[model samples]
Target chain A: MHRIERYYDSIFTKQSPEQLARDIMKKADSSAKKRSFRPLAVVAAAAVVLVGGVTAAAATGLLNINELFGGRISTQDEQFAGELVGAAQDFQWTTSDDDYVINLKGVTGSERDMLLLYEIARADGRPVTEYMTNIPEDGELDCAENLGFDLNAGAFKAGNYRYHYSINDDGNIDVYNLAVTDGDISGQQFYAEVINLYPKQLLSDFEAKHDIFDWAGGADTPAGFYRWGDNEAFDAGQPCDVALNDERIIGLELEWTIEFTYSPSDTAKLSKVITDEKSVVSLNYEKSYGGVWTYPLLRITDSYFSSVSGRIDLVREGYMRGQTFDTCNDIYLLLENGDKISCTAFTGVSSYDRHEKMSSFSVEIQYSEELNGPITAVDISKVEAISINGEVFSLI
Target chain B: MQGDEFTQYVRKYSDMVYRVAYSCTHSAPDSEDIMQDVLLKLYICEKKFHDDEHVKAWLIRVAVNRSRDVLRSVNKKRTEELQEGLSVSDEEPSSDLHTAMAGLSRDHRLVIYLFYYEGYSVKEISKILRITESNVKTRLKRAREKLRAFLNDE
Candidate 1:
């Protein structure tokens, strides 16, 4: 055995992991039981949950955004009421439709998080799903969930989360959040444009549950949501909503351009900070071969923050060795109320090139799994500080 | 994923998971406890895998996560647990490198084990740990430095 392998073996061979594995599996079989359900029924149950609650939602064909946003917070059910409601910032903007209207109720945030309020429903929504038969077939599910909308600002593309919706007569609300990461977002005019939607989540779940992925042909659709039997040429095995921009679906053609100027709240405050740190920026080693590690200086000419978003403007001092990569530093908004929010989700192109000195580009601080979803970061009194790359700039 | 197929995967992947857990916790008992939970999770995990590689990947990831949890929960008793659980065999390497590695943190040991012992690149390790590649590289370098520091102290 290789000496290193021997060393590792000596450390662990005292316990026979392979034997243990067999033993555990035997034990697992003795203790566990198997359960199965029809795939179509499971899909129905999931749809009911996606639309809203099961028991109450089946009675009404429309969605329950209020309940879905946090939970049914009736005073009678005081449990959910205490934790969530106060933190969301309320707004009233509804796109009108005959069957359903998409409305924005509010966005909840933390310093660097734009967490969507709830879990991503797929083939998982339960009891209420069986009752609510209005479950959208294909593209409807995409529209029902948050489809990515492009947010355009002056030169930089702003960051956005999924815009989720449910259509109903009781003013059902659909919502999405933009991370306040674009530091210079104050007074920047932006118009959110709804575009093609992809049912990647649903497709994956279906594949996992029923193994019905490739059966639904999606070659014709540009935006990836399947249309019902768009690919008769390929195989009519399953239905897909691939024709997302098909004019027939009115929900898909939300052509109204609602232009809005984003001005920070009156209580909004700003902080200024700068950094010129010289550090080993990147390492490029792939064990089969020797690799290069670069020592680059991150020169920030100016980095600023409003209460909502945080931005750090960079001025590069040229790499000493290898990389000229993009550095999307995380922008955090620390609220007065002990909550920390990471609002910087930049959709713009942010890369630092040695040839192009001090270029202002944007890259997403790619929300790690840690910052998974839309967070409750709203309704805080004031932001005490904004942290960027380990440096805290006070905003209070 | 059921029947003989499930058994085959559990037997193969569980051993990999236990090795990963052992590297992270350096405590056989803790590693065993973590292995049990992760094994049951494997037995019950519904996510279908494309291949044995996928199953191995999932198991190792779960093992790493579970080991971290054990490290955190047993932080206070860690020193006692490590000494008690790991009996130094007479054949154990007395090299300065080994000594330094022995004193290193669970995170450092984990990164080192994945890189040197398992032949996984920093990039692959980053994906498994859900951290940036730079972070994985940084951990490796820091582990080396801290290990050398231990050798110097000796």
Candidate 2:
């Protein structure tokens, strides 16, 4: 159906029977020659063969060492044995000790072979950094054939080919290597809490979306999003106060605090201070849109409300944008110390006679340098006023 | 079975084995080499042909794998096989089909060859290739889609 398939099929179908027969004959001859040839090393090392054969001699362990070594060696079987033996490095093993542990496993029967390991380190392995194929897990050790193993999935498809190995120097200290057969599998795929994990081999073409850090593991998690605000919010038509506490030396481990205040019964007061390094920094905000409302009898569509009330409504668009807005006139601040700070009007207050109310407004910000980022706090202050049936009124 | 019986097995399955080898190698010479090599391996393995199907499938798998190994070893030689007898020019007389096929990835090419040349259904290809049936079906569909794009683009 597809040209690629059609073309491949055509060429494949055209392979001549005569050509195949000739090639088969040639291969048969080469295999026969290879079978007949014996190296001089095998001839010179009789004892090596005797010793080497013992390890695998008894299928379920029947042969005595002395008998196995003393028995008459069949020339053909010895030759076959020589061909089957792999290099010494193939059987090498490493150990890992301490609070951290690494174990290795080898799989056989793959187009490409591998050694894999699952490595774990102490929970407090500070600023923990782990390498996937350290020491024995990499290079020659990663080869499947060397480890006398095969992979069930061809190397290209099976997410990754991995092996396990550990190293222990007899001290309290230890390191683990998930002996990766190739750079096929990235450690992060299987190992949790790995410092950083990005898929490398096997379907590497599937690119991951960036920008959002994986905050919580879910579709609605705070990943795939960017942070904004200068980083502060404003009440639509007003100037936003921004201040950065650049005095302290900012390091990845640094912590700070933020605070904000505003006015006219329409206010938002919030503050935050970082408690631990690597701890998540969360900012809580509360904004109330305080204003006057009027009902117009001439506009039938505007008659949803028979009368107007002066209220400061806190509009929250929920977690993500485009959701229905929830209005709240009251906001309660939850602090790290478990103390709740309630926002109260400092001066200007407004009221409406089922029609007009309100007065002056302004916003303020307070911040604790104990947290990261600038403008930790925002406060809004506004003048209160009202309109009633083509009449303007002010309340305080 | 006797040597004669083994030889008969080789003769009957040689073409099928070579086709699979060629699918992996994209070369007549390498495919032929794998066909004979697989047969020789079967002979020494003392593996009896329970039925024609078993023997045929074994020969194909071994031939394909052996050819792949050979192809992997010869870097320069392998590229030559990929390029050989598969190109077409605007003015020259050549099969654009081969040209397009030479451009498909190994998985796509394998599925295509098994489906069309070997006359294997997706299920059979899955079993022979040691892959999931779904994977075989997907690969076949993708290979066809790629070929269709290559053909239309011309």
By TM-score, the best candidate is 1
DockQ for all candidate structures vs. native: 0.13, 0.07
Worst 10 residues of 2 chain A by lDDT: A246-255
TM-score of chain B of 1: 0.80
Q: Against the true structure, what is each candidate's TM-score?
A: 0.40, 0.36
For A1-396, candidate 1 gives per-residue lDDT tens digits of 154466666554344555665666777666553314366777776756644422210010122234233332332211221133234434222222122233334445542333333221222222111112232211122222233332221111232223333322222223343333333322221222322233222222222222223321211111223232222323344443322112112112221111111112231111101111111101111110111101122344554544334455543332112121222244565668866675534443334455433234333333222342664334435767656555566655
Please list the residue runs of candidate 1 whose C-alpha ends up more than 4 Å from where it truly belongs after superposition: A1-4, A13-19, A33-173, A178-396, B1-15, B74-85, B88-95, B152-154
User: Could you report the Cα RMSD, in angstroms, for every candidate shown?
Assistant: 23.5, 28.6
lDDT of 1 at A32: 56
Q: How does chain B of model 2 score on TM-score?
A: 0.80
Docking class of 2: incorrect
Q: Per-residue lDDT tens digits of candidate 1, residues B81-150?
A: 4453354345665455555666776667788888887788877886565445645655665676677677
Strongest candidate by DockQ: 1
How many backbone clashes can be found in candidate 2?
63
lDDT value, residue A228 of candidate 2: 21
